[model samples]
Target: MNLHPRIAADTLPVCITPDAHVRLMNDNRWPWLLLIPLQEHIEELHDLTHEQRDRFMADVNQVSRVLQRFTQCKSVNVAMLGNVVSQLHCHVVARDDNDPNWPGTVWGFGTAVPYEPGQADELLATVRKSFK
Candidate 1:
């Protein structure tokens, strides 16, 4: 329950486990996934304890693998930028060279193209299925 203020507004909920909250980036242009650890008052990865860090990384890997498998993305990008949200979270982006922001960063590149209702639901379902 230690989510940051901006996450709810900027992202759509996908699922919540003991260690992290999995969310869709709300951008359909790219398959951007987020893993926000449920640890309270943490703004950086280093703030996590050793065990917590391990579990967090595991969650990140799980999401990254599923993203690659499902999206057939050329490359997967992972990052944790706290400047805006200030929460301890990881972004797992599925990128292709042809993308508008190709060979560069996805942040602040342009306005987000959100997922259609069915697309979003299907994506969420795929991710949840992968976990099981």
Candidate 2:
């Protein structure tokens, strides 16, 4: 299945699991990742079959653990809001009390801060290694 254009534009490829395509959000303010299921035309979680859902959840859990360990943040937030992009995807974000959007959601909280040259590459390498 092809990724939604918006997601493809905003994220960098990370790695793929059995059920989903993992990608890192371009923003550097938070350690955020997206898990997009590999099924076609799936706009909601309920659209996935039982086995697919299970696999997707496993992918989410794995990504969350990786983010938690890598960031050591105060908390990790996960959500699947398809309001803007109708494609089904899960967001796993690492949050800290000192973050700019502390005590609130990251959605539209502020403009994204782009990573410096090679910054995203370094992070992607570290995260990819952790998955192994």
Candidate 3:
């Protein structure tokens, strides 16, 4: 399935799982990942079939663990809000008190800081390796 334009614009492809397309948000302020389900026209979690939902949850759990392990952050935030982008996607964000947003949510907090050259590449490589 094709990704929503907004998601495609804001994220870089990381890896493809059986049920979702994993992408890394471009912002370097935090370690964020997006898991977009491959099912067409799915706007919410309830829209997924039981099997699909199970697979999607597996993807979320795996990605969340990978993000936590890679960043060793204070916490991992997982959310599925479709207010701006209606696509069925999950956000796995690594949060630490030292991060810019800190105690606040990353949404609409500030402009994203793009990853420097090779920075995103290194992260993508690390995350991909963990999935193996």
lDDT of 3 at 48: 98
Task: Please list the C-alpha lDDT of all candidates, in the order they appear.
Answer: 0.87, 0.90, 0.92
Over 63-83, each residue of candidate 2 has an lDDT whose tens digit, in order, gives 888788888899999999999
Which pairs in model 1 have colliding backbones? Answer: none
Best by lDDT: 3
Deviation (Å) of 95 in candidate 3: 0.1
Q: Ten residues in a row with the worst lDDT in model 2?
A: 122-131
Better of 2 and 3 by lDDT: 3
Badly placed stretches (over 4 Å) of model 1 are: none
- lDDT tens readout by residue for model 1, 1-132: 756767777789888776899998888888888999888888899999999999989989999998899888899999998988888889999999988889899999899887777787767888888777
- Count of clashing pairs, candidate 2: 0
Residue 121, model 2: lDDT of 75
- How does residue 59 of candidate 2 score in lDDT? 87
TM-scores, all candidates, are 0.94, 0.94, 0.96
